[model samples]
Target: MKEEVTQNYLEKVKAQIAKLQSFSIVRIPREENIEADYLSKLAIVKEGIIPPNAPIRYLELPSIFALDVQVQAIDYSNSWTGPIVDYITNGTLPDDNVKARQLKI
Candidate 1:
């Protein structure tokens, strides 16, 4: 059912794409979009952004074991794809036997 909805949406999108002379879609990471991110942060901190009677309770935890303030995650220094790409390109394996065996499997 989800796939059918996706296919229908894609067909509509393709029809629109055909009508356009030129268009490009580029995904910007949230961290890279600092200006928009700053605006959003300001809006969230403002009191009465929503009605006081609104049942929604916003819980922003700094850490799982934390107060309302939390720090951003450090960006992936060694991303998940690093090991996989190394294994495929140069047949490199982690020094740990367990991890190398798991990768093979």
Candidate 2:
């Protein structure tokens, strides 16, 4: 339903553009467009000054711990673990495979 409405709006815009005597869409950079640059800065300042009655929505971001890769879930019994574990656990490198060859590395 939303897609149909968007498609209709786009078709109307295309028809309008086609009917125009001269039509050219040129993108002006923010630095080149002084009016738009000033408007954007003004909008930022206006948005910052929130009204007393207006409800402000605060988005709660997910924890970094949740995004962290699960080391416990990964099977490390077969692969190199002695040196890696030693470095992690006791701050010492393994005698054999000093460099842990993993898929991520």
| Top of the candidates by lDDT | 1
lDDT of 1 by residue, 1-105 (tens): 668766766776787699799989998887998665655565677664753333454567312323334579745339887667778878999888998898888
Clashing pairs in 2: 83-94
Candidate 1, which ten residues in sequence have the lowest lDDT sum? 61-70
Candidate 1 structure, TM-score to reference:
0.30
> In candidate 1, residue 24 scores what lDDT?
100
Give the runs in model 2 whose Cα sits over 4 Å from its true position: 31-105
**Which regions of candidate 1 are displaced past 4 Å?**
32-105
lDDT of 2 by residue, 69-97 (tens): 44567655466674566567666644445
Q: All models: lDDT?
A: 0.68, 0.59
lDDT of 2: 0.59
